[model samples]
Target: MARSSTNQNVHSADDSSLDAGGARALRRGLQLLDALLDAGPEGLRVVELCRACALERATVHRLLATLQASGYVATAGRFRYVPGPRLGRAAAAPGQPNMAVRLQPVLARVSAAFGDAAFAIVRDGPHSHCIAREVGTHPVQVLVIQVGTRQPLGVGAAGLALLSALPDAQVQQIVAANAPHLAAYGGMTAERLHLLVRATRERGWSVIGNHATRNVLAVGMAVRDARGEPVAAISLASTLARMPRERQQLVARTMREALAPLAV
Candidate 1:
């Protein structure tokens, strides 16, 4: 009886030690996730994460590996890490409905002003998901992207605007990831997308043609969250002839004005 009691005690102690170790690991992992969430889409490198979480490099790496494997975190480039598809999926559960409903008014105002179709899209991992759309009173409407449409980031004017707002390093990483699918869209290539990103940054808005839709031109501007992070994009689309250089500028300005009062 004495020997059996000693064995049981030893087993209980072993289990207790394991439970404590597991709990510590879970806490460290949660800390890393908190840091990533606060970082938003811009993400952070391993070193940055180490500093943010105040954890050892090896500990962060192990936790990140587990998170990445479970799809809670993703690599932005060779160095930086961002929230992954699983995290986005979790947010989508409570986020998509609110985002779609809230942006309807903003889309309506922008479309009403421009007399064209206005669309709102949010970044979903490497893709852009159209959550809301409003059609204007124009006789000839450009309905390129509809509500619920999903496309690779940088494929459409709205998506491109969001993409251009990301850091250049993250941009390259996304472009490279989307390279294989670019050919299906108007022969778009990594090189071409990079050029467009540069142009969009320089112009302070985004314009793309013959890509999302044939013979259609779209102008887009990014909508930022309170943190000034690009969270969504607003775009207006029209026929190529209706969106000449001068008209594009006017549309961009109109969108900016309409969105000025937007809280998000």
Candidate 2:
């Protein structure tokens, strides 16, 4: 009876290991899909796919084969893999709402209220990426950021807003690692950066003037998740001439009030 119970325990452990391995494989497959989605029509070579997905060549090849068999991806010229027609069809299908869809109404309202371009951005590793944007109806508008553009995480309002929401230790680590790029921007010295971050944290927003583009100014506030960690940010950008001191303060007040409900 003792031997039988021991064997059963061993079998259960082996099954658990297999299940974990299968989960990891599924996760890798999803990572491959994400890489393809981000690469768009350009697709990716096997080597590039492997590197992006952090998988071995053989593993990526096998997963690609499986994805191809399922009509979710396709290969071209024996080296590149891209999302197949089925995937595109799925993307074009009606009734599915993505993050952009959910955030559109809020962005529209903010843009209408502020009379400036408003954007929603998500952090992507060391960069912050614009996910959605609504341009202001004004004739003279600021149009520096577009959807899918990546910006360094220590320079702009959106980046600073998101960085300010991180834990102190993590923020320090990221700032240290990105010191070189930060230095290029001229206001990224450790002392200045820490001060800005602290102020952002205290006020729950960040503002910048013409750092990324000439004649443009921006203000951003962090959007936190349920656990109160920053998950995203919303920013409004306008021409500096149109956004003089009083107007800037008014816009910032309006934005802060409008975005308060979105915080965790």
lDDT winner = 1
lDDT for position 184 in model 1: 91
Candidate 1 lDDT over 18-88, as tens digits, reads 99999999999999999999997678988999999899999999999999899898776556788876786
Clashing pairs in 2: none
**What lDDT, from 0 to 1, does candidate 2 have?**
0.75
Give the per-residue lDDT of model 2 (tens digit) for 96-135: 5555665666678778986788888765545677889998
User: Per-prediction count of colliding residue pairs?
Assistant: 0, 0
Superposed Cα deviation of residue 196, candidate 2 (Å): 1.7
lDDT of each: 0.88, 0.75
Estimated TM-score for each candidate = 0.72, 0.61
The whole-model C-alpha lDDT of candidate 1 against the native structure comes to: 0.88
